[model samples]
Each structure stands twice: as C-alpha cells, then as structure tokens.
Target chain A: MAHFTKATSVHDWLDQRLAIDTLRRVLAKEYWIPKNINFLWAMGMVLAFTFGILLVSGIFLLMYYQPNVNLAFDSVNYTIMREVEFGWLWRHVHAVAASVVFLIIYIHMLTGIYYGSYKKGREMIWISGMLLFVAFSAEAFSGYMLPWGQMSYWAGMVITNLFSLGSLEFNGLVEWIRGDYVPGQAFLDRFFMLHVLLIPLAILALIGLHFGALRIPHVNNQDGEEIDFEEEAAKYKAGRKRESKVIAFANDFLSKDMFVVSIFLLFFFYLVFWHYGFAMDPINFDPADGLKTPPHIYPEWYFLWSYEILRPFPKDPGLIAFGFAQVIFFLLPFLDKSPNAVPASRRGIFFWWFWALVIDMIVLTAMGKLPPQGIYSTIGLVAAVAFIGLWIALPFITKMEKKV
Target chain B: MKELKILAIVVFFTLVTYWLVEPFAHSQMHKHVESEGFTYKDLPALTKKGDAARGQELVMGAGACVGCHSIEAAGMPAAMDPVTNSASYGVNPPDLSNVGALYDAKFLAALIKNPAHALKVEHKFTPESGKMHPMPGFYGAGGDIDQEVADMVAYLQSIAPKVDEITPAQAFETACGRCHAVRYEKWTQIGEKPSFKKKRDELVFETKLEDYKANLTNYMGKLPPDLSMYIRSRGEHYLSTFMENPQNLLPGTAMPRVGVNAEGAEKVIEYLEDAGDPKRAERDSVGVKVMIYLLVFAAAAYLWKKEIWKDLH
Candidate 1:
C-alpha cells in the first residue's frame, strides 16, 4: 500500500512523531481481503452506510418529536410535516430506512447461511450479528412509538402485553417492561429515550465489535473454503504477517460498496419522495386514543415471521418457542457439527433442507399476516413445526450429507 | 475519482428528489383540519390553565355539556332519547370519565369553539342535513369565551383520576355505570328504586303495554345500551375522539357532540383504561426497573466477552 497524498512529508512527520503509521497499517492498508467475494459480501458496508443515513435522518426527526403523550402525534403532523423545512423528507427517510435496513440485513443473513459463514471461528461474528438483530428490533419498536399515532399506541400495547402470557413471575416481568399496566405516557417516554439515545449507542458499539471480530479471521467467501492462517503466518518473515492477492478496501471494494449504496439510495429516496407512507399505517396519522384501537394490531413486516411463530401453540409455550427460534439461529455453529463447511451449491441435501426452511418461513409469514382462524391456524401450526423441526434435524442432516 | 463521480450523482438525485416532492409534502400541512390552527408553540399559555370548579359550572349550565354528556361525577342525566339522537346525530355520545388524559388542552379549547372546525374540510359539516355536528360553538368573535372554555376543561380534568392511580372498580363505576350494569347486585345497590307506579310505567315502556307509552313521546323512544362489558367491547381511543365530535369520527348517526373539553376527555380515557386493566400504573413503574437491570446486564455481558476474547487477536 502507498500513501497517495501530496502531503507525504507531513504524514511521515506525524507518523514519526506519534507512531500513527501502525494505526494506518492495521485499519487502512495491510489487512487482506478475499478477491473472489461477490456483491453479497458488500452488505456489511451497505448496512453501515444505511445506518449512517438513519442516524442523520433520525436526528432531524428528534429535533421536532415531542415524546409527551398529548403532544407526540401533533408534533409529527404539525411541526415535522408542516413547519420545519424539508422535515417531511427526513421523517420519511428515517421511517422507510428502518424497513429497508431490515431487508438488507435479512438478505445478508441469508447469504451467511448459504455460504456457511457462521462455521467455526466465525461463530462469534454470527452471534454478534444475531445480537445486533435483536437490538435493531428493539430500536425499531421503540422508535415506532415516537409518533404516538393510533397504530403506535395499540401496537405498543399489543406487543408489550405478549409477555403477560407467562406465569405470575412472567406477568410481573411484563409489568416491569411496560412501566405501567397499560401503554401510557410513561411507556412512551422510556421508549423515546431508548430509540433516540441508549439502544443506538449500544448498536454502534456492537457494530464496532462485529467488524473487529471479522478482521481477526478476515472474510469468508461464497465458496466456503478456508485460508489457513497458521500456514500463512509461517510463510511470512519473522515479524511480518503474510499478505494475499487482495483488493484494496479503500480504493476498490469501497467503490463497489458505494456503487451499490447509490443504487439502493435511488430506491430509498424514491420512497421518501414519492411513496413516503408506503410502509406506514394510515391510522398512524391520527393521534393516539386509548379508547379507539385499530382494526388489526400487528408489527412491521420484519417481525411478522417471529410473530407467526408465536401463533401455533398456547400463549406461554408459543412465546417461549418464539424466543427460542431467535436463540436457535445463534446456536447454528454448534448444531452443524460436520467437519466440512460446504456451500449449498456442493451440498445438495443441505440445499434442499435450507430452502425448505425458507419456504416454511414464507408460509409462516403469510399465516402471521392473516387472523389465526380455521385453515390459517392449521397452516401456521404446520409452518411452525417445520421451522423448529429443521433446527432439531440439522446435525443429523449434516452428518447424513457427508457423502456429498 | 469514480467513487467521487458516483457520490456526485447520488447527491444530485437526492436534491432532485427533494425538489420534486416539495409540493406533495407541503400539501400535507393543509390536508387535515385538525392540523389547522395554532400548534402548541403558537397557543397562548392561558389556554392550558383553568379553574375546575368554574369549568364544571360552565359544563353543567351555559356550555350545555350536561345535555348531551353523561358524567358520573357531575350526575348529568342521559339524553332524552339516545336512539333518536343516534339517528339524528350519527352516533350516541359516550360517557366522560377519562377525558382529561386523552387530548391536548389546546385541542379541547379549539374544538369547543366550533365542533366542525376540529376535522378536515371534507369531514366537517356537509350540505346534507344529517351530516353536520349538532354541537354549536360555545365561544369566539362577539364574546371572549376563553376563560369559560378553560374552566370547563379544568372540570373535566378534575373528574379523571391520575393515570397511575386509577382502579378497575373506580374505572367501571365512572366509565360504565351510567349505561351498563356490570354486576346485578351492584346495579341493584346503585340504582334508585322507583315507586310501584313508576316501576310499572318503566315496565310499560319495555313491554309496550299500551299504544301511547309516556316515554314514547321522547326522541326515538330507545333505552340506553347496556355497558356491562363496554370496557371489553370498545377499542382504546374510540371514546376519546368520539367525545370530541361524534359526527366527525363516525358520520350518519345520532350521537351528538358531548362538549367535554380535552382535560375531561383524558379523565374519561383513564377510567376506561383502568376498567379494562387495573394494573397499568404498576406495570409501567416495574418496566423502568427492568430496563435498568437489562442495561447493567448488557454492560456486564460486554465486559465478560472482552475478557474472554482479549487473547484471540
């Protein structure tokens, strides 16, 4: 790697004065990345870029959003939409970006599963990613309440009340989470703090750790092959780490990442500009009324799969199983004990099994969107069984597929 | 250089989008009549202040709040003919037990001045005779009714319990006792026992003993609906907006506007919530402690992870 800046002398002086060269080496230059990775690998950077947009747009929204129960909805409708310059655009971006970020993350996770990126040393990275997913879910939920619309209030009530399904202890825990027996100003105030400050800071720290963990083992490729770190270390001179045929992250991959970001932004901005309310509930435009509830109370689409998972069984067991479903993804590395980390392309049996889970997820999502009645209940039950069944059967399936 | 070019294109597109969508975004401001008038920032501070006693007086007397609204605390009578009123006004006015907790004080004052003014132009009084709100503006222009409206709002607030302090029994009594009898024993205890002749007259209204029943001369001659499980039947927020202007929320029914100010509406809402679920305040308080615990737990987990993985690099 070479320094392209014309202020080379100044940079060299700074390097000598502060020992800043090593920082540049580790963060900017010497780290090697696989040359064969494709567009799917770019999602991490895309997510980071999108997160930056959300932060910027969210700041603009926070400027006008009043977390008080009486003023919240009106603040959005009047101050943000009418009074502030370009405030409407920023609010729409903040909202629509939440849904889009979830979409990107879902695809990224799907890619990881297909390429077996969660295997072995990368398990912590996968786990961190899962934790981030949970944090993101919380962030989205808390942020949804800032508007204090009809949907916001009812959805907050419905989702928070889910915890009461547990025993006496669980009911106590639910009360603790809600801050009140019902979703009131207290709940709104607490959620506002979380959405604006606390959870976002945690997410930022988790993101830093996620990338740090990734740098340790380098990146995984779609081919599901390992680059032997010990052998590479041995090949290098005593003090220097071995380097591979690599792409410069700042020059090459950053360009690719930015290009994808620009294309994604085109669509994102289109939604913000033309179809701003595409992902929002119409009832949300109205101020929250404790006495009037929307006809249907459901979460945003990202949560529909998990919400469906809770539909099949009795209340407590269903909620526990729903939680386990999220936890089960973190245990994937241990569950797939086969020695080989094979991509779906080469592993025919695992490929079918994986798609089956995908299909089950889709079916469950559909069932979740419908009222749990008659045939929908039966369908939801079947999909829920298959979802859990796939996890239980993973190790055996992996072992059985050794011949492939 | 290529990255810079792509960045430039993205910036250009964003600017274009901002320009193109300005009209649509700005148009949204004028879309809802509720969005019209002064925001909280523009409101005079006095609108938020009121004397509950004075407000109560206005509600019962000059404001005519008692005519349409049935308030347990004030002991306001039910409408003469809820069925006929429902037919004329579009829907039956709801009781006012939790009105203070539901809306902003400024909104209450604005709505009281002109009932149709609370909604968008499309939703306001239509030329069709039955589509308009029965509520007449109580203040403005020739007379400065600010203090009166404020007092009425204060009285509404006085009736509602604190959000955290409401009990299910209190909620049921305040919000539902007027129309619905929850427990037979409780009903018998609360209801005034009519004399023998009066009971017979009441029976005649139900049984239609003769062609000309005394209550028949009343509007539509319909009894108020039972509220035994209204806590369960009506969704949250229904009564809040409904009480503001029944015609605006649900058109083509006989429910006249109840004229309970915003503070009063909030009290009614609190009562409704308390009736449905008594444990709300407790739940919210416990939630804060749970959040603090989770934050500490998260921090501890992060530190433990750092300790375990320190050598991995």
Candidate 2:
C-alpha cells in the first residue's frame, strides 16, 4: 500500500484485487536480511530444501509402500524396487534425504548456537527449532519402521521397551506403543499413519512457526550485533549513497541460498546414486524376525550422542537420562543468558568450552556406535557428565565474562 | 544475470537427482537376483491334508523318533544308550514334547529334508563324518516321503501342546519345564529314585508323572538345561531356527533332528511366543485404540495451533 507499483496489464487484474505485488515484496523481494551471514547460515535453506525433497519423494513412496507387517519389507525391496517405475529412485531419495536433512540441521543448529542466534527475542525461534528436531526424530523413527526390516523391528522393540523400566503400570505404556508385547502388525500400521501423515503435518506446521518467529527480528549476523532494519529502510528511502547493511531477501540472499542448496543437492544426489545404502544397515534387508536378534543394536549416526548418554547408567535410570538429554537443549537459551551476542571467535574463553562440548559430542557419537563395554562405557559416562556440566556451567560463566 | 544463474543451478540439481536412477535400478535388480532365504512365503504348499494318526505311527516306527527324543504326551521313554549317544553326538537330543509349539512347518520340512542345510551349517559334512551329522536326510528323494513327513509333523503337532492362554506353569512345561524341572527337590524326597510303568496302551502312565521326573537323569546322559527360563535364555527367533536342526546352530551337538511340518513348527513358535510374553495379544489390541485417541488429539492440536498462529502470520 505504501509504495504501490503501476499496474502492468498481465498482473494488474490479480494485483489490485489480491495485493499480489505487496505480498511478493513483503514475503520475498524487500524482506530484510543481514548481509554479513556466511555460508553456515545457508544450512537453514539447505534443510528446507531437504525437507521438500523428502516430502515429495515420500509421497511417491507412500503410493507403493504396504504398511502391513507381513508385506512391508517385501513391498519396498521386491515389488516397489522391481515392479514400480522409478520407485527405487523415490525410495532412495526419501532415505537419502532423511540423512541429509539431519546433516544440514545439525550444522544449522551449531551455527545458530555459535553465533548466539538464540539470544533474547529469538527464544521462541530456538525452542521451535528444537521442537522441529524432536518431531524430525519421531518422523525418522516412524519412517524407519515402514520397511519392517529386521533392524526396524528390533530397534522398535528395544526403544519401546525402554519405557517399561519405570514400573508395572509403565510396562503397559510400552506395550501400547509397540502394539504388541513386541513390534508387530499393529505397530507397523500405527507407525505408517504417523510417518506418512501425522508427523509430517506437524513438521510442516512447526516449520511455518519457525519462519514466522524468524521474521520478527533481523537475522543474527557474524558480528552478533543486531542490525537496525528500520534505519536501513529509512536510508534506502532517502536515497543515501552508502551501501545497505541489510540485503534484499529476493534476488540477493535468495540467489546465494539457492546456489548453496544446489551445491548441497550435488552431494545429496551423489550419496543417493553412488552410495545409496551407506547409512542403511545391511541387516535391515531381512524381513522382521521376532526370533532372530542381531547382535549389535545401535541407532543411526544422528541419534548416537543421545544414545551414548544412556550407556553409563542402568536400564531405568539410563532411559531417564536419555530422555533428559533430548529435552535439555530447549533450556539452553535461558541457561546461557550472555549479555554479549558476539560470535564464538570473538567471545573469549567461552569458545574453548563450546568447542570442548562439540568435541565431546563427536567422541560420544563414536562411543555410541561401539559396544557399550570396556573403555567405551567409561568414556560414555565421562562424556555424559561433561555434556551436562557444560550447560550447568554456561549461565554462570557467560555472566562473568568480559564484554567484547 | 542472477536469475539465469539461479535457473542454471536448479537445472543442474534436477539433472543430478535423476542421473542416479539407472544405477539405483541396477542395484535393486542385483538384490532381487541374489536374494535367498527359507521363508514361509517361498515354500511350496501342501495339496493333501496331513494325517495325525498316520504321523504318530511313522514317528514311532519308521521315523525312529523314540531312539533319541522323548515326547511326554506319547509316554515315549528316554533313549536307551544316553551315555553312548552323548559321547558320540556331544549333547543329548532335545525332547520333542513341545516341538509342535516351538517351530513352524516350513522350517520343519526344510530340516526333515536336509538337517545340515536347514540349520545353515557351513561346515563340510561328508560321508565319513556321518556321526557328526547325526540327523540324516530322512526324505532323501524317496517316494511318498512328503506324505510321511506330513503325517509325522501332524503327529508331532498332536503330541505338542496347543498354543492357548499360556499360564506361567503351562509355558514352563511346554518350553522348558519338561527338561529343566523347576524345583526337583520339591517333587521328590532326597535319595528317592523316580520310577516309570510301561504298559500295553501306555509307554509311561499319565499318573506316574513324578516317576518320569525322577528317572530324568538316568535317561539324559548329561544334565539337561533348565527349561524354566529357556524362552528367556534363547530368544524366540533363535529357538525357532535352532529347533529346526540343533546341529546347524551348534555343530557336533548330540541333539537329533525332530521331524515336524511347517504348521507343527509354527505351533511350537506360537506356544513359545505365548509362553514368554502372554500379554502380547491384549497389549496389541489396546495399542490400536490408543492410536485412535492420538489421532484425535493430533487433529485437535492442529486446529489449536492454527487458531493461535493465525494472527501472528
């Protein structure tokens, strides 16, 4: 309304009635973004692209996938792979997209944390991102069961059984989740609904909230100081010759984001084609056997950190700790209430603690893949302790640190 | 210029994604070609109905089932040369009273055809090591072998306990209680030897159950494993495959093959599943209803989120 464009005949009829031009300018064209953001920030767009690929490919896969316990694995491996046109491509794309989504999101989250993107007004944004992560995990887990392979069956059994450690009553909850004493047809059917329909809808809604929350404030920059978008807008209007600190969302940042996403696509497609089954466990090729249990029962790489947190404790307590580890990230924005919002490179002393936690996570991930015995168990305990300790120490340490 | 670059990137991304389809199709074809398993879906279906009575006769007579294994329902007493059998085979043959409840028909047929093949035994079993492969292929290209196997499997099914509401005691009896007596001391006085009565109609009377329990050690060369917890010790899958042919799971084992059909083997599996986890059915039924509740909750939550976020957007 403020800067109305002259009605061009092609879009004029729609533009006057629907304010299409205004919507475009507000949503895409003139939207303000910090100019200083590096390629690390591009991971957010990369994750969005990955989600798009998953949703489209998943829809294709859903057409052929049989949710029944008896036919699920065969449908994916035999019928869909051989009978359906381009079905193998869709399945691989969905599977490969899942791993890539996690990869991008992890980098995105670390970048957010390293740059203090969760500070002050961005609390809701950070929390919603964490919730998205939780939903994505649930989505991934439910999707994994669609194949009804040996690993999926046993993993479902092991994970659901974790809920039984509380009491006799809690054991009922475990059975309810599993739909049987173990994973079976009922479990597969329920998970199918969750994977294809329910969780994806929830994820879409959360992504909307994530973007909405992001729009309220100027994008956080490498310098950590928030840019004044109002001043930039005023300067642009006054015809100042100086270059704007804020970049236009449409042609500038969008192009850069898409360019990075394209580069990421090259890698993602490479993994899908050349190394299609790299992240997949070969044992999962076999159909679900309630009788034959695979010796090693480790989770996918992304979940290894949280899984490692449980190894040191006994069953009931270990499960409790694992649950806490997942929920603990939500409390991070409040815990580290640092007045300074400077990037990690400039944030003296705190950078070491941050990197230590990062390194600790890497170690925990490795330990998670290893059998929970001997030196690995010891390392799991030590790392878990250190992981929690960093959060506890964060608020106190940040408050005491000198301003940049 | 920027728009053209973006278009070029988009085109490149699309090309890269589709490029791998050919390779993916190749691997998928490879998977189909190489796949091999003794799954129930892959086995040939039986045209004729199995005869339990005929099966009983073949199991006791031609099958020579009683030479090694014991079935509680048949009152079949333990093998005569327990020591010699154990010395030659390494362990005593497992009792087949619950074999019906432990394995399915396909596994049983595969085992009866070739014990070594059924067990997935990788060891080179030759004619010289005939002693090592204790359970010979009974259906070795013989005419009427299929019918004989079907009858024997039916007979095993008849003797083996049917899968029902398996109480702890019944579960123990079927899966482990036969071999591993729960409390041997409670059943008999110290120094009292158990006895068995052989009769015309009964090999061992149903009344002298305690007597059979007392003589278990004499019949079994080595102490049998405690059955009270065998279901827990060996998982359901391992038990199914192992029951098909113990030699495959454990090489040089004295456990002789118990010839059963696929249905008989499945009955045993059902019994074991029931024995270890009796509440599976009840739990599964409740799960569907809970999911329905979750669906409603998810719908309500979606509406609520829409209402809350409407103004913000």
Candidate 3:
C-alpha cells in the first residue's frame, strides 16, 4: 500500500492553482466511512444540507430585510408580498423551515445519544456536534428577533430579561445582543445584523471544526450491532491495496446513497404536493407589541422536550436559571462512565436508554402543554432519576453483561 | 419455511402498527367534544326516493342550481353557461350530483349558505396560497332574504345524494328552489371579494332581512365557517332562530333577526328535517392517485413478466 503521501499542492505538475481532480479522486477512493452505517449516519448529510440552505437563503434575505423597527417589518412585507413574485412564500417557508430543521437536528442528536455515537474516539465528533447544535440554537434566537414583530419582541423580552441576574454575568453581550434596555427596533436591527452576519459565519467555522474532528476517527459505534469497520480494515491492511481497489467509495456506497436519495425525493415530493406545507404566521408584517403575548407561547418544537424539563424544575421560574442547566446537560458525553458504547448484546441497557428518552420526551412535551406548576417538580424529579439511571446504571449493566 | 417465517413476522408487525396509528387518525373526531363533532347524518340526503329523472328536470330548470354548482358526473359545466369565464380562472363551482361521494351534510350545510367560506375559510388547512373562490361573503348588511339561503340549503339537502341528511326532501324538490336561483346568482356575482351582504343596495330590499343579516354577521365578525349546511354543520337548528332573532342564540351574536316571517321560517324548518341516502361512492379513480398507482404497478409487472417469461421460454 502507498505510504501516507505528504499534503501536496500540485501546482507545478498541473500548472493550475488547485488540484480539484486529485482531491476528488482521493475522497472517492480512500475515505473510510463505516460501511454498516444506518439512517442515523445520514443525519450528518442532512445537517450539512440544512446549513448550506440557511447560508445561501439567509444572505439574500439579509440583502433586502430591514431590521430597524422603522422599516424592518413593512420592508419585509414589501419584499415578500409585492416586490418578489413569490418572495412572500419563500420568506414564510424559510422562517417556518428553520423551526423544522432544528427539530430534525434535535432528533439526529438523540439518535447519536441513544446509539452511543459519542463513545471513545467518537467523543470529538459528539462534542463538535453538540457545539454545532448550540450554535444553531443561538442562530435561531438571534434570527428570530430580526423580524421585530410582536411575537419576536415579547419572546426577546422574556429571554433577555434574565441576563442581568447577578451570576450568569453577561454584563454587555446580552445587552449588546438586545441593543437596548428592552427589546425594540434598535435591538431588532442589531439582532438582524448578528443573525445574518455574525452567527452564520461562526456556524460555518463550527461546522468545519465539527467535520474536522469527525474525520479524525469517525464515530465510535464500538459496540453497536453492526460490523466494526476499523477492526475489519485492520484485518485487511496487508491486502488493502487490492481491497481498496475492490471497494472504492463510489462503487461500494455511492449507488446505495443514490438509491436512498431517490427514496427521499419520492416521499419529499409526495408530502410537498399532497400536504403542501404546515402553514404558520408571517411575523415580520407586524411590528413588535409588548402589551400582548400570544396565548400559545411555546418555543419551537425542537426544544419541547427541554422546555418540558424546565417546566418541572421546583425552583421559582426566575431562580432556575436558563442556558446553564442545558450547558451542563451538554457535558453528558464526559459524564458517561462506560469505556465505550453500550453493546447490542447489552439489550437491557439500550432498552432502558430508549425508555428514559421516550418518557422524558413525553413528560417534557406534556409540561410544555401545561401552565408551569409545582406538581411538575415531582415529574421532573422522576425524569431526572431516569436520566441519571441511564447515565450511570446502564454503563454498569453493559460492563456486567460483558463480564458474564 | 424461511420465507413463510419472514412473511408471518411482517404481518404481525403490520397489525401492531395499524392498531397504534388508527386511534390517532380518523378517530380524532370522536375524541373531540361530541356536541360539535362530525356525523354522517349531518350531510345532504333525499327523503323520498324520487326518480333521478324528475330530480334532473328540476336541477336543469328554474332551480337553475346548476347555474352555480357544476357536477361533472352529470356533465361538464355547460361550456355556454352564462357565467362562463367569470373568474380569472373558471370557478369549477363545487360539484353536487355525486357530492354525496365527496362530503357529508354538515360540510354541505357549511358550503351552501357560503360557498367561499367552505373552500377558503373552513378548509384553510390546505397550502393552496392563492386561487380561492370568493363566494361566501354574500350576506348583505341588509335586504338579503335569508329565506333564499334556507331554500338553497333545503334544495341542496333535497338531492337524491349519496350522503343522507337530517333535513327533509320535499322542500328541495318543491318550494326551496323557487327563490334559491336568486341566491346562487348572488353568490356568482360576489366573485373576488367573496361576501354576499356587502352588495350595494342590500338594505332597500327588506327590513327584517336587514336585522337578521346584521346580528349573525356581527357574531361571526371574523371569517365565519361556511354556511351551506348551516343546519347540519352548525350542529343545531338554533341558527334558524338566530336568523329570526339572533340575540336568543348567542348573547353577542350580531346576526340580524330578519326575513324569517312565520311562514318562511316554518317552511325552511320543514325543509331541513330529513336524513336517508346510502348509495354514495367512497372511492373512485381520481386522476392523480390512479395515474401514479398505474405507473408503479404496470412498471413492476412488465419488468417481472419480461424477466421470468424469457426464462420460461
């Protein structure tokens, strides 16, 4: 087998600035993505596609969207309703699609968690993914206030009011994000700037870092039910030249990827035509009105499970500190004690994992549907115990099962 | 034996999935409050099994119901109908001949009093952003004879429809059609704006017509549900009383207490009281569904036949 070649710029040989063909060839040949990857593996592609869509569309939107309350809303309405032939439709679709994409990301994250995609060498990939998720949420919040509508203004007011509570200690950035003491037109303008400008660029950087870390070792599906590829590759190292020849990425997986793409388009178009879309309000047409809060003030559905968790916290709403609780939860990969992922042979561990996730989800969404109350504390405590059980008990169960 | 084992497992799982999903699907109606829920009896129906032959003549004649509702099952909208090309795109007014196949009386009731409301307002769940017929806003602030709305409702309910209605049949075939033509004519005219009562000079027509229009419209200030099958879709006959004097129905209802003179109100009531027809087609070949299914199945069969038949030869 060829020894690892030094990173080469082929400018001298090709007399060209970039060697696109060589890069393509290397990727199409040597990339060692897991051959046994299932649907969860697809989520990376989905996230990549979503990020691209957000970037391209967001740039065009920023060009026309006015974030100052003076013209922010009406300008959006003008751009969408009257100026661009189908601009209104696109604007609404993008806003609503952001909600959907994040929900999808949340599901993708859960799939990773449950399948133990974060164990061992996969830790960087998981941590990078979590960072991307956090950045994505930050992007969503900043983007939401750009429209500066009654809904956006009130939601901003509710979120930013907590910034000054002595400990979380964002003395300026929170105010900077708001642009004023309270959410209004100034806040809206600067938010639009950050949402369209700052966060998107940072998101791109984080995505690169994520993929960079992911490629270091790929995911640690160490004990999943599938064949382990790195192990399989080690066995064939002596024969890898021939083996790689036999199973070039294009030949082995490209056709399968194409088939999956075909099935995806079939269902996607079926829903696009049949259901058209799940319609929602276009918020930018109306300026922010602080006096009123929409009766149904749930966060985007991606956060429903977390919102459910927050609902059950026994402390008073103000005392229970937002974002901190979640940042702690994000450190779950480190907290996990198992040396590697739970093996499929340890069915009891996964079963418990599945139930904990499912119950937490149900209880959280149920909490979202209700007014926050004290009784929910009991429910949250129960859910927390279950979460702790999976985090601690399941690892032990897996270890004992292996020993047995 | 191995294949049989796989098939058995597939069947077992299919049964489980169906059970889990069924309660969430069409059963949502039963899950909601029964007082204002959908029922089969809330649809259009004919009491007496009259000859479809006689029913055809009335439909074709002064009832001129076909003037608005075009049921292609009978024939495509007459190419030469008076209101041809009236809409920017032709309004293929909801077909009623086999509407029994399409919807129940409650839906029909909502559609009749207000056709625009039925399409755009009630079924707002559809993502068809534009391309809606504005027909429901026909009620005038004054001078609309609500009797015409009642008669139209009665006659529509009177058809020998697949869907059975709780209303009576004689009114549609006989009395309901007399003034109903004017109603559909009014609906046809209120094209883009989609309101009936907004027509100029609506007040000069009558006094009680004014009051009845006023009260009902006020209570339903925001886009109200369609009114075609008001009796059934409303889940009450109380709406008619509101038409007589709407204040009785809901305290703040702006609906006028008009056009329900004792005779007209009784006649309208008598018309809305029959329920029985069972010959509706539940499934037929729609162009989209049939074309896709045909394409998929035919391709599969042809491929299989080619592969296996060559070997057989």
* DockQ, all candidates in order: 0.02, 0.02, 0.03
Q: In candidate 3 chain B, what residue range of length 10 has the lowest lDDT sum?
A: B275-284
Misplaced by over 4 Å in model 2 are A1-10, A165-169, A237-242, B1-313
Candidate 3 stretches with Cα past 4 Å from truth are: A1-16, A74-78, A81-83, A166-176, A220-251, A265-287, A314-325, A342-347, A371-404, B1-313
The candidate maximizing TM-score is: 2
Tell me the lDDT of model 3 at A252.
45
How displaced is residue B92 in candidate 2, in Å?
A: 28
TM-score of chain B of 1: 0.41
Candidate 3 per-residue lDDT over residues B280-313, each given as its tens digit: 1111123256447645744554455444323222
* Deviating ranges (above 4 Å) for candidate 1: A1-19, A228-245, B1-313
In terms of DockQ, the best-performing candidate is 3
Q: Model 2, DockQ value?
A: 0.02
Minimal lDDT window, size 10, model 1 chain A: A236-245
Task: Evaluate model 3 with DockQ and give the value.
Answer: 0.03
lDDT score for residue A262 of model 1: 57
lDDT of 2 by residue, B8-121 (tens): 743553343233223332233222221122244434555446799987776787457776677766887765433344444433455677666555666566566676665555
Instruction: List TM-scores for all candidates, in order.
Output: 0.57, 0.59, 0.54
